[model samples]
Target: MAFIGIDLGGTNVKGILIDQSGEMLRQHYLPTQEDADGAWRDNVRDMVKYLQNYWQKPLTAIGLSAPGLPNAQNSCITFMPGRLPGLEGFEWSTYLGLPTYVLNDAHAALMAEATFGQAQHCQHALLLTLGTGVGGGILIRSELYQGLGQMAGHLGHISVQAHDDERSVAGMPGSLEYAIGNYSVARRSHGRFSSTWELVEAYRRGDPLASYVWLSSVKALAVAIASLSNALSPERVILAGGITLADDALFEPLRAFLDVYEWRPGGIQTEVVQAQFGDMAGAIGAAGFARKQHVG
Candidate 1:
């Protein structure tokens, strides 16, 4: 049997076709084209149609990883704003005509980790997606807490610093999102570098200004991790998304800052690690979800 999954993001739409054994048979990608009218919905239709025609195989089930609060019925997007213009309140199943499951993209990423990556078999963990925008998911006792509003694991909104009057659209000042998210990094850099990668590279070369901005982000994340640890006591903190590609440059300082900041009841250290899977995590997790729902 084969399952199909889609990971819909602000910039791109990615999908996968996977066999029952969890091996990817084929993959697809298309620009989200948030700038183009109706492109978000159209690209998905194209990908699904193209994949089915190319493989000459009908999917057993389809799963989607989308942004923001997907309605409980798994049909409409209720609260994702500034993503795709027409995404909010859109009925996905009606548009696509498939037996579909939709979940928050962060949830899908964490589920992917829980099902087959570093977090497999772990009873409690937190996964943070550090990208152009930050996203997060929580696993407790081996279950993904989808929350009543489907917006529970929004860890990035946790405030870690005081930015005076500055705030994210979520209205949290000095939020982890406003600190470590790619947009925030670039904004705080004041155009010293056009991209976060450039800032990271400059930091790697020991540039003082770059170090200041980078360390502030590291500290803010450390503070957020500590707060989460004190409240949830998760066994591990998993870092995913594009920023983790920085590897040691990000983790080493993050760990050091976490040590200084985290307040644990027994002086225990929470293990921090990188997530497995890369660009494929969202698609893989979405298919994994469909496999569980349809096959298991």
Candidate 2:
């Protein structure tokens, strides 16, 4: 049997066709057009059609990894920012004409890691994705926790400091996203760099401003992780997305920061590691979810 997984981002739409054993048989990618209104749903429809034309078997189910909170029924998006404008009222399951499941992109990444990546055996885990923004998902007892109104795991919006120079639209002062997210690093360093890769390279070469920005960024991330460690008390905290790939310069400082500051009764000992699946975690997790749903 084949399952379809769609990872929709602001700039690209990535679709994957995977089999029961979590092997990707085919893949598709398309630029996210800004001029196409309601393009979010349209892009997905196109991808589905494209995959169907390439695959010999019928797709069993479709799983979507979107950027905002999925509605209670898991058919549509409820809260999304300007990047995804028409999603608030779009019915993805109906549009796709398939048994569909929609989850926040971060939540999808968390699911991906928990099912087949780094957190496979862990009962409690937290997955943090640092991209254009910082996004997070918490799993307790192997189930994704969607708090009241399906807005529970908005970890990136949490306020880390009142006087933080970086403030996000979520109204939280010094939000983790504002300080540690990819954009935050570039903005803080006053570099014209387009992406975190440039910042990481500059930091590696001992650029003073880049080093300062990188350290500050990791410090902010550590602060947030420490707080999450205390609040969730998860067995492991997995870091995914582009920024986490900054290597030891980033992870080492983060680990050291956690070692000194995490508040826990037994001396704060949560294992922190990079996500095993890297970018494919979403597609793998979506396929796993589809397989589980098909069996259940």
Candidate 3:
């Protein structure tokens, strides 16, 4: 059976056609325009229609990974930001005319990793995606934990530093995102580089500013992960998204910091690894969730 997965983001919408084994049979991508009111939902419907037109067999279900709180019935977005205007309170399942399973993008990414990526065998894990901002989700015993209001896993919002600096968002002093996110690295490094890859390369070349910025980011990430480890005792912490692509420069320092700070009972170790599926994890997880809903 084939499933259609849609990953809706601020700047683009990606779709994938996958079978039961998670193989991508087809894929599509298009720009996401913030200017068009209600255009996001229309784009999704069009994308689903386009995918269905190409497949020879009937699709089992459609899964949507969106960047907001899904409605109570898991049908649509209830609280999207300005980037996705007209998404809030939109009932996507009815609009698409299909059995749909909608999930927060971060949560869907966690599901993808737990089922098919680095965290596949782990019983407890935390997935963090460090992009324009930081997003996070938690899986315990291989089940997604959607807390009350479906907003329990905002790890980036956790205060890690107690500075009186005005850079913090919404009065949350020193958020993890402020320290470890891509923009944070750029701001701290004072380099013209815009992406984490450039910063990583600079660090590799032994650039002093890049080294300082990278170390600070890794330290903040380690502190956050350690606190999470102490609280949840996850078997593994998976780092996803573009920022973590800094490769060994980021992971090595993060691992060393965790080793020093994290406390484990009986000296048990928690493995920290990058996500295997990279950007496609959300789509895969959405497909998986859609399969489950169809089966039930």
Candidate 4:
């Protein structure tokens, strides 16, 4: 049997066809066309239909990975303001003509790891996707933990600076996202850099301002991670997304800060690592999620 996973994003829609063994059989991508009226849905439907027709085997199930919070039943995104028009309250099963499981993209990323990637064997793990903005997912007892309103993994919205006036998109003041996310780089650095990569480059050149700003962001991230570790006590933390591309520059300072901030009892500390998958994680994870739903 085969499964189809669709990852719907602001810029693109990615779909994958996979077999029972979790190996990707076919993959495709299409532009999201945000300005078009309900055209993106047609594109997604076409993509899914193409994948289904391309594979000769029986199609077992379908899954979707998308932005915003899913409703209690996971049937649709209950609230997704400001983007992906017509996505909110849009039921995939009704549109796709198949029983479809829908989940937040971040949760789907963790599901991918849990189903086949680094967290496959982990009873407890955390995944943080640090891109334009920070997002994350949680795993407890090897199961994805999507709390009330499926809002459990909005880790970046957690505040690291309580007194700061800056507010994140989630209405969080001085959130971890604002401190470290590429979206706020210009505001955080007083216009010195437009992107996190540029800031990291300047820091590499021993630019004092760049060093101060970048290190501050890393410090905030460490504090947030340590705080989360205390709360969740996961076996490991997997970091993904573009910001992590900073490599040693980001991890080195982050490690030092974690050493100071983390409470390692009996010398046991939560391991922090990089994610194995990249841009395709959501689509792959959606397929994995669908397989689980189908088998159960």
User: lDDT for every model?
Assistant: 0.84, 0.79, 0.80, 0.92
Error of 2 at 214 (Å): 2.1
Q: Each model's TM-score, in the order given?
A: 0.90, 0.89, 0.91, 0.97
Lowest-lDDT window of 10 residues in candidate 4? 287-296
Sorting all predicted structures by TM-score, with the top scorer first, yields 4, 3, 1, 2
For model 3, residues 1-296, the per-residue Cα lDDT tens digits are 88998888777778888887767788887766657877767788878888898887888889899888886677877876765767777776678887888899998898778767787788899999987778889998777888877886778888788673635544577888888777665576675567777878888999888788778878988999999988998998888888876778888888899888988778798888888877777777787678656553
TM-score (C-alpha, index-matched) for candidate 1: 0.90
RMSD of each: 2.2, 2.5, 2.1, 1.0
Error of 4 at 94 (Å): 1.7
Query: Candidate 4 — which residues are off by over 4 angstroms?
Result: none
lDDT ranking, best first: 4, 1, 3, 2
In model 1, the runs with Cα more than 4 Å from the true position are: 54-58, 264-267
> Which scores greater on TM-score, model 2 or model 3?
3
Q: How many clashing pairs per prediction, in order?
A: 1, 0, 0, 0
lDDT of 4 by residue, 162-185 (tens): 899999888999999999999999
